[model samples]
Target chain A: MDLEDTLLMMPGPVPVAPRVLRAMSKPMINHRGAEFSAMYDDCCEILADVFQTKNDIFIISGSGSAGMEAAVGCTVGKDDVVVTLENGKFGERFKKIADRYGKVNPLENEWGYSFDLAEVEKKLEEGAKAVTLVHNETSAGIQNPAKEIGKLAKKHDALFIMDGVTTLGGDDVKVDEWGVDIAIVGSQKCLAAPPGLSMVSVSERAFEAMDEKGELPYYLDLKAYKKSGDKSQTPYTPAVPLFFGLQEALHIVKEEGMPARINRHATCAEAVRAAVAAMGIEMLPQLDEFSQYSNTVSAMKAPEGVTGNDIKKDMLARGITIAGGQDRLSGKIFRIGSMGNVQPKDIMLTIQELEVVLKKRGVISGLGAGVEAASEVLDSLL
Target chain B: MDLEDTLLMMPGPVPVAPRVLRAMSKPMINHRGAEFSAMYDDCCEILADVFQTKNDIFIISGSGSAGMEAAVGCTVGKDDVVVTLENGKFGERFKKIADRYGKVNPLENEWGYSFDLAEVEKKLEEGAKAVTLVHNETSAGIQNPAKEIGKLAKKHDALFIMDGVTTLGGDDVKVDEWGVDIAIVGSQKCLAAPPGLSMVSVSERAFEAMDEKGELPYYLDLKAYKKSGDKSQTPYTPAVPLFFGLQEALHIVKEEGMPARINRHATCAEAVRAAVAAMGIEMLPQLDEFSQYSNTVSAMKAPEGVTGNDIKKDMLARGITIAGGQDRLSGKIFRIGSMGNVQPKDIMLTIQELEVVLKKRGVISGLGAGVEAASEVLDSLL
Candidate 1:
């Protein structure tokens, strides 16, 4: 199969812009050279702007998970008490990382639910030094209240760390204003760059904490990374070409103003959610007040006699790639992403494809109903 | 400056093959898709063949350092004893990583010297559970006695780990025969792919150790990665485009037989070394027996009155890029790479450019001397 021609409707590894792809095709350059340093400087500056932080930002040549590890390792040392808000898979991953190094107080919530700030505040009152949360839970299509959680963390004098993997470019993440001590972003999610590079912004409080406790390991040590970034270089050999692509991707993000980018994702989410609702499917997270527009990769109830895997397999046959729920929801829900470079037409086509796939699998679906519903929503927005 | 036109003569982040660049330009795909799984499976099989092992191979969406951390985290636990042969910057990095989770017995050597296998044996005999060494130390232009050290580790019952970052595709590495329980490779160096993905192979013995002590942290945990790779996927989102490029690059490596590829690198190395010698310059590592012909890079001494930085800057002015020595030898030596898809013409042009740069910087007698020397060597062989 020609994967290049197939449309990626998944949450991440989203469709990259042609310009970004062309930019990445440029030949590699010396990472320490003047030209590359200029590129690196520009990337750091623009990434800080995107993250809305004046604190030092370091680019790690790893995935979002690596960024999480770096965040956990650099901030909380061995035997530290960490309170993790686990509303979804990504949040639980933070607890897993914390469990590796120290004691973890997992503030568990339902899979399709988000954390209540009051509950988190209660956990923080129990003497936790750090609190971790995810901005967007890709697994469950839920967006947590990070700003509220940050406030709670501040009230308790705990370090607030956020995994902004799927939310950075498509959402507003004011690290300083939100009192986030460490904010991590992956290149592939909303930035429309291929995944490899991860950016983290560390607050002065976190830096001081790292200085106080010097037990952190070498590679993930935030102090060493910060020192190296002062020279526009990483402590190790970075993924140079990916850095180039990121520079171009960040440029595109800036060109499309941040508010407009977020609105675009919101529009896409609204169109998808409206169509799914019109098709008589229930949204997993029923709390509209807590619903975020960063793009809802909504989980729908499978039709009679049809499984989520059945719909996913049929969608794949029709040249569309959607995601199935992970962990407990794996066989129950289907996920379609409307973030990054995805256009209204892409969404419309996806809905149409979904209708066909559902019908082909002998599930109950009206012919052309999904497309009509999505188009009506798009027309009203346009 | 047009980075695309400038030849990459540096040790890594080298110019990728046109085919590899084109492959990377392919559109992003869902990491969980069957097509992606197929590509991942193919790449892993080719990587295992290249390492000459029957062990399971994994490709992480990160740089060489990420692979190194995974290797260290997987093999050694907290308070485990690890002996590292520190000869250059990368070896020091190994010591740093070892110090993170375990006690390290560092057998330190000079910056430009190869490790003494007898000394490594002595250290391992002093109760180290594992021995870490760089197969080819790029910073010093030295290839350690991996075969001898592997035998020593077997006699001492220590897990043998080698960093094959710069040597995997350009040189012969028999992982099983060399008693290397774990071997790591990066995409940019000799694999001819862009820098992002790192590959690691684990022997059955390493797997057994991991099975016994399965408490590694997430992200760098081998057990998590191994479980995911059983279905041909990573535990987290991967850099999809880079994997596409790596799949193509691995196919090219297999198309050209491993021995033939190693011989090609040897031929290029001999020609580069001959040209440098004729210019009355010394190589960093003087012992010929310890020399490795992974033409990926060759370290040479700076001429009298001309620092390695001076030569590198001059080359950059002429749109060529040769790397200066890293860490302690930063201004003392330079390195030239002729591996990957670099052809004879590229070597000849680099030689011509080097002669001009050297003469312009007042380091050599004649402008055409180095080119003539290189051409004579090529004529003798070809």
Candidate 2:
């Protein structure tokens, strides 16, 4: 039964709907044929709506990291300087990818900390060809200041690349308005599709600059994807079944409409935060006035006398799977993913389980308090 | 219905089984968890049997071309001189990939033509670091002399990389015995899984040489994959559903036994060839004594009156899809895939369909001739 028997509450790859899964069971077709072309074209059209971009978008058979690599490796030249802003793991990954192709000026910050826009502008002033930011830092449960940073990148004429792996479909990300030349999103994240596909949207400026860098690595080359995407075909053989799942997922999003889905994600995140607060637990991310909490994942500090792993195991025993801290934050914090297909009932069940775990250890005031708080938050949204 | 209504007879993306498709519909779980680890381990073990090697295998998210790029890009340094052997589109692709990471000395041959080992040996003697050969060029339906070229590479102390995208499962490929340092395979080809994942097997020599070349591209990096794969995890988020499909496909392969499956592929190819010969059509590849035909796909020259496209259209109209020759050979030759779950009935149906299409154009004497020849071939195999 796998995750079907348990409630999957981790960020990205949250529970997938049965409709989407069934779509994947369809027989394989000619990727170069007319049927696939039409299906692919529909996927792109619906994706444009979710991405909220007039720019051209291409789907590739790879991870979100592959999409991140394509964004930096295809545009930045060896002699070019890139400004890599880091506050979380994915942001650090951008620096890693950029360092391979260009000279990097990093604005490194502690995990869960916000970036200094003025300092970031200084790096762009040094004439960087490109700058990267993870719009939603899932690792830290914080959303970076993309709008402010994009303004700086625009003022300096630096190409702005945003990794919206967890924010694109569930949050308000105006790719065009934020001046994002390239926006990358993973299928398993807010899109609620299977992992393994990355969708990248490119602006006119980014498209033109890619050619100047000469040929990119053969597989992740975006131009080739564009040429094939125009005909509703992939330049290389695609994972056809995953594309079917993603298209079905996107169609669900289209039916619900972006605004409604985005609001639902916000409501779910707020409910989780409310339940945690009612239980007297503090959040991990130290958010500023300009910076904000992530609307897709919640990172909470582990209560006194217990580690995050303790709470995680306790929940797992009760048939709920939440995430513990990664890397340096391990055992210090716990995470509950509020992205993709997650509903009010999922949040209620998660909160209820957390209450049971914490009550046994006498961390919470009593049973039903957290759920009541979460219900109030859900009721307010309604 | 997509390819469900029709009999898909194209090379590479051969028809996937319903059981394999259903496996992909399973729910996604934590990739780092114990469940995924066990499943991934099984996939690797089963895949090793298909590859017929003791070397370590890694499943990466990308196309067969991506696997080809990984084998070449990860080992060859920027200053290294490598020899690339080319005879078809995919062979030319290996040369293109090798050119990006190292200095390439390519031995170019016409499509469907065999390589001259003496000339290849001369190039290897020029102190090349690595040599690449496409074990099976699906574009031309030709299987190159991998054993002979590998012997030459061994004498010259050059790392031998083989693109076995279409041959590993269907045809006998003695990777270790052939002295191949690296071997690549695609999921959608003989494996009959979805097309989005590429599994690559690496030898100790290739593994040790990868570090000397420094860090490769971020996503395509094998060292990282090896580290995580040791724990039944991926370095990045993998296509989980595809992994499920591949595991199911491998389980089926294991149940049938690799030796039996390999024999079936050969018999299918032989049956198709016999039927085509009965119709008096010439095969595309001019196989010499050392060189042999591809057991995964059969490419035959179009008859004088009808072009390859005409034949392809007729097949499609009759709900049987075959491939027209690609690139330069377009409209001149047609390909029928004999890989994956192609059974005796599938072969009989394909030949029967071709007979009806060609008989109308007065190319074949009668309809029963082709099926009769194919039946005889299939009966001999039984």
Q: Best candidate per lDDT, number?
A: 2
Clashes of each: 0, 0
Clashing pairs in 2: none
- Backbone clash pairs in model 2 (N, Cα, C under 3 Å; residues 3+ apart or in different chains), count: 0
Runs in model 1 lying further than 4 Å from the true structure: A1-3, A288-296, A359-365, A368-372, B1-3, B288-295, B367-369, B380-382
Candidate 2 global TM-score = 0.98
lDDT of 2 by residue, A236-345 (tens): 99889999999999998899889999999999999999999988999988887778999999999999999999999999889988999888889998999999988898
Off by over 4 Å in 2: A1-3, B1-3
RMSD of 2: 1.3
Interface RMSD, candidate 2? Answer: 1.1
lDDT assessment of candidate 1: 0.82
Report the Cα lDDT for residue B138, model 2.
94
lDDT score at residue A328, model 1, on the 0-100 scale: 84
- What candidate 1 keeps of the native contacts, as a fraction, is 0.76
Query: What lDDT tens digits, residue by residue, belong to model 1 across residues B181-264?
Result: 989998988888888788999888998888766777577778788999999988887887788788888888999878888877
Reference-based TM-score of each model = 0.96, 0.98
